[model samples]
Target chain A: MRWNYLIAGATAAIVGSTSGHATTYMTPAQARVAMFPSAASFIDRNVVLTPQQRSVVQKIAGIPVRAPKIMAWEAVDAAGKRLGWVIVDRVLGKHEFVTFALALDAGGAIKGIEVLDYRETYGDQIRNLKWRAQFTGKRHGATLQLDKDIKNISGATLSCRHVTDGVKRLLATYDAVLSDHG
Target chain B: MVLSDCLPPMMPSFQIMGELERRCRPLLGTFVEITAPHEKAIAAGFATIVKVQSLLSAHDPVSELSAVNRLGHRRSVTVDPWTAEVLQRALFWAEASCGAFDPTLGGLMAARGLLARNDSLLPLDPQANWRDVHVTNREVWLDRPLRLDLGGIAKGFAVDCAIDAMRAVGVQCGLVNAGGDIKGFGPEAWPVTIAMPGSREPLAMVELQNAALATSAGHDASGGLDMRHLAGASPAIASVTVEAASAMDTDALTKILVSATLKSVVCLGLAGASALTIFVDGRVIPFELKEPTA
Candidate 1:
């Protein structure tokens, strides 16, 4: 392995600039149309969780409820037939924020999910101790520049665990409130 | 002046960039993002990825790869042409790397609990290697009972397939990124940033033009060198990144470079790829392939 490492000074020059920018993949309206193309229209059916409903959602989801309000819409065909529901939610990580839309059939089964926007932000103080513990052996915690031009990232695959967890919580929200609202 | 008048007039000497459409969806146990000039092109690219995932995923019990592992020892099983193509390419790498990049490490992966065991299949053969598996046209069979995992290479193949799908739709420029196995082709270069292992810190930046780049790293959580996909080799480096013409080659090459030998160097040369090994101490080393003697 040592013989293979002939140090070359050909590494690409690092651009020095820092700007916080979120990559918006889709909007809620676009996502609604994309997830349910056949639906004629969407009806706003946003919900605000009561204290009891929040507790129920937390119990069912196995994750805490960060917000009481949830943005959602009901997709109906031309003849007033219910196509499905679209729920928009956001998952906040220590360094990332992911806003996504989840679509479910009338029976609450997941139809599809589309990420609306993904933002990675760095703070002065890292809050997640457990996540930080993974890199305790590093000599330095290098500061990353969240540049808009750098669109692609290559490295150890970042786990979408937060989004997965967020999906589970949204499902619980559906069971707790949206399921019996008809 | 007369000769200049014969040429077509220059229209501002500026090109209008197309409106890029981007979308991300959860697929293949990860987020698959596709960016193209049109919505239809992006949709087609994603559909191709979804198809590849359905055909090649080892986590799905009904996937063609799972079927091959479950019953290939009993009888030859025919798979989709896409699956066959991926399998043939995998076998080629397995031979080129001299078992260094074997696909038959699924048994070990299952034993390590990295892969779920399918109870319906017979007990795994401890000595099973790539040699035990044979591919004849679209039919595949195993000489002994052994699992097959395409987790390392399938994601890259999916990215490549998605690129092909977008190109088929007359898309001249596009990018498909499946959990960091990135491939982009356009009139201009795509800038990519490499993140440090276990953290979101940018380690290096590389510009990709009509090529793919893949990075494989260990997840020891202690910043130690430990990879789950390696069968019997102990990799000294923390991460390996390969840039090649195709995502599939780059993906497989990253694994082969984990414990690269002189033979692997020749293999890299043959594949027209270059590699960079980043140490645990944050040192990035590029491979220097010496030309063979006449």
Candidate 2:
């Protein structure tokens, strides 16, 4: 099984991304609207947390904050009211990683999660809307552990754990970086 | 609505490039990526994928396929036009591949716990092959107790459906790649890399000019040796990639090549289609590209 994984991983690395590999499941603009259909506008921002801020994010998210720099978008309505934040993040699966977006409301609660691109043959159960709905309404400081809080799919255990961990990290980033500010 | 103007001066306006947009969603047990020039075309592409998924998903209990599998063995069940069309194509391949690409393996797969059960009836009949599957007047009947699984073929057909949708929306050039099964339509020839089995780099790159490509590896879904019937066909080949005029044909051809002996591989060539086989020992064999003699 392990040997097969290595081969699968290697094969996926090649086939998943080649010259014509810019296969996007949803563009940032589309995802922003899907997560917040009534949003009047969006503001894109590139963030690189300070060492102190990174430490704070790590403490809150309970996961190591690797690459403290990220690009996040803020979606707002026509009335200038903030709708939510859309952050695209990638997490490694059994073979290749899945690119996804974690949408959060102004209060740091999850609004929705959308898978952007998945390269693995298995462990795709994470893309189910029912599976993603579990994270809705979850806020920072919530215990976002797999099996305990998030239900694990029978075949997609690795993706389940890793995505759960990724969500925790994103929530922690929100609490540390975007929670109090606009 | 000029929503951008409503934002405060502090918020920067985002400029969306109206170039080709690709979006992926989970469907057909894998991520289906649809690309188009505009949002409307993209939406249509996805609608096609969703439509096929809802109609054909063997695991989705509410799918039309589940209904057919649940009751077709007992009585002839009429299916949607789309279902009938896909089933017809599946039967064509089942015959073309000589049971090598059998949809009747649903029972065997389910018994092995590879697929979720659609009904309590098990396809235990060894004689239950594609020959026993009867289709007429958009209705289907199985002579024996075997469930049909279109997993190997439906996905490719879905890609074709998406391409058709894209064309319907007036998109000139775009491609839909569901996992590794790809179909490039319109003007541009999309470039693709055929990844070697268990390697992180391309074994070969080809310019896909309005063509369809499908690959099958020796490793199963669980990343273990695939003991499927292909083992008896060619045990040395680790992976097989086939390019044909349509995704549906490429999808079925890969299965035939994966399980075919080298001599049989040479005999299965069809015009406008070609195949390349990679062995576990790193040997690469490209089959003669010629039309099949019916």
Candidate 3:
């Protein structure tokens, strides 16, 4: 019995070192780099929309900008070349919150998208690789509606719609805020 | 380009106090959201969470928990005040649940490859019950060589600590959600939803007024593993969501209700928590919370 226990412990120790716990896939900093591989540094920028900008953002995105101001990061490469923009945003899923990174290029097109953290116990089908891939290279000015533009997951309606709406808001914010800055 | 003339400076009747000031950071292997009335409160809340994570994380090699797991059997190891508080609560639940919520299963979990080992000797016999672990004041002593995994309840305790930090900074109206183990406070009740497995709709929508809610479901609830299996939880349970005055209680109770045997149900009922337990066959049981009478 002791020998069996020893063997089991040794096998588990080997497996544990290589695998990570389910919840943590990537940290914010790691997600920033993964989203913009060409970028060498990320310049942290915070934006408090003016009344006019907020109104336009809400009108364009068709969603309320929860806070008066928001935060984003500018990914810059060596010699000060701009790579893209990284925006960390949250959306209410079926339950709890779904947080992701909206990586938009200089031309206001989505470069990549990654789920940073998911809080809901179910309906995480939004994190499916195929679903996320459809958003890549989509431009901000386009009508990026949930079912109208991005395909919805079968049993993850709220997560799909809310995440799509969040992306739309990110794009509108990009056009209103970072388009000129970049 | 400055459209300041055409727009109002700010919306009228928009109370400044009602404005949500929020921040997020990666801690305790998940995203920690701290929403408060001021940046000071948010900063303090995040700091408190990080402090608790470092002290109690079983995976961290330098954590006090790791040290205790390594040498507590040799001598009574002095732990942080917060660690002691959490451990005391854990022990209570462990006994209350009749070993269903055992913390001493850390080594068993490690041996089963659920959690990483932290340089502690694995129990050969593997039945290192919670009763064997002892705590007094700020010291913890283990009767035998067994690791203690606080992964089940540490996050909730950290959330409560964050709430405390917010109150310390005079921020009353806010919510702290550490990977969906949420505690909400203030005059207004916070709306919470528990998602139904394999469906888009929610199983329940509850309001938390200065309260906490925690959900423990099958790993496959989100197309994942059976996480409760690691804790020796009953295979019949599909999910359990508990709401209580404290996140610590709710967190620990979810595990207990899902895993405890039928005989332990009476004691669990006397503990005074409202819960919804969904069995694997779609049967739902709701226990309305009763306030403890003085």
Candidate 4:
């Protein structure tokens, strides 16, 4: 029922982020200067999580602790098993909103993923159950090709591209974090 | 006091739906008119439905059939006459449809995790297997305990019962429509319309005089699991309707018609019902009623 302190903090940073209680939000400046500086400009870009989404996540987290609004996530699985927890971040893109989640297993494999939320209207139907299922057994070595590796729904091309791109970027961020922590 | 004891009157017609549901819980389609509506015949007619429903339900705590279905891999079990009879017809339909109209599909539906619990919470794993359900006289045993989902066929059976109940009431003309599958017995001739599977517009209508008509369309508003029952099917077709002598015949025939070539339409006539098959293309294949046998 209780997680270790480090996992709890990371989980709180990821899961309880943007929850009801008001705390210091990672401003564009703070997010740009402090975290993922390589992708700061991209990470600190426009990000909006609907209250409905925040509510759903809060209910799922079942935690009442206060935490800052985070735009970058890094979930850790201390004991490699099932999907431990997911880290989500809203990265602004050239055309649309790109919210993505990075799921880590106990052994640091990307157990599951979600293009958590996206607004690339065209050809994005891939994420709606059919497309999300493709990443079920995906690991770090899984190819991230938009055209060949990931199949896009015909009508939602923009969405398919954005998701595949977001996944690749999240993996880059995960790699940078893992090397640092290790 | 009798009909009122078991059911509330939703309409002035015979309580066909109530009868089927009470008799067969986990029943697929419980609301289809088998009996014609007469103000005076309501009591006698509805009472028959109630009795039948009680006989069909698998709710008894210690019923031999329920035990087999709930706890399978059994040797043998004794079945009541009515349950045995219904199972007999179901077996016949399963064979006739060449596995299209299977009562054994409940297990498969459960395994698909398609079953919604009584509390409406979906099970973590609900992949059903038809092989799990085993049927023998008096015993509805299974290879394993899997969830049973009776979606299409149950509605058809209820409609058939409604038709019989209407005939017993001495009312000559009646129509029983469960969700969508309909069966009618017109005093002279019943004019039935077949709707285009997806579109609300009427594609074609016919007069069913001396027999029953059942229409099955694989069409769903959302179109979830259509071609799942077919061999190498991709759920491309919209809906398929078949007219048969009995509602069960029509219900089971629809599945066969979807996979069948033009050659199979003749077998519909052999099964004893006039044929009017419609596809998503708007082409209608019509057949006259067949010569009666068994």
Name the top TM-score candidate: 1
**Ranked candidates (TM-score, high to low):** 1, 2, 3, 4
Span of ten consecutive residues with least summed lDDT in model 2 chain B: B5-14
Report the interface RMSD that candidate 3 achieves against the true structure, in angstroms.
21.2
Question: On a 0 to 100 scale, what is the lDDT of residue B139 in model 2?
Answer: 94
The CA lDDT at A104 in model 1 is 99
Kindly indicate the candidate among 1 and 3 with the higher DockQ.
1
Model 4 lDDT at residue B268: 67
| Top-DockQ candidate index | 1
- Minimum summed lDDT over a 10-residue window in model 4 chain A is located at A150-159
Per-residue lDDT over B119-212 for candidate 2, one digit per residue giving the tens place of the 0 to 100 score: 4665457778888888875898878877778877887889888888888888787778776788877665555556545432334444566878
Candidate 2, position B74, lDDT? 87
User: Quick one: RMSD of model 3?
Assistant: 17.9
lDDT winner, 1 or 3? 1
User: Per-residue lDDT of A5-33 in model 2, one digit per residue for the tens?
Assistant: 11222233323333212234666667888
Instruction: Write out the backbone clash pairs for model 3.
Output: none
- Comparison by lDDT, 3 against 4, better one: 3
The CAPRI classification for model 4 reads as incorrect
Query: Considering every candidate listed, which one attains the maximal lDDT?
Result: 1
Q: Write the per-residue lDDT of candidate 1 for residues A1-182, one digit (tens) a residue.
A: 11111011211112222232357888899999999999999999999999999999999999999999999999999999998999999998645688999999978899988889987653222222343333344322223334534467787765576888999999999988888762
lDDT over C-alpha atoms for residue A161 of model 4: 36
Q: What DockQ does candidate 2 have relative to the true complex?
A: 0.06
After superposition, the stretches of candidate 1 with alpha carbons farther than 4 Å from their true spots are A1-22, A49-68, A92-95, A106-109, A121-145, A180-182, B1-18, B219-226, B232-235, B288-294
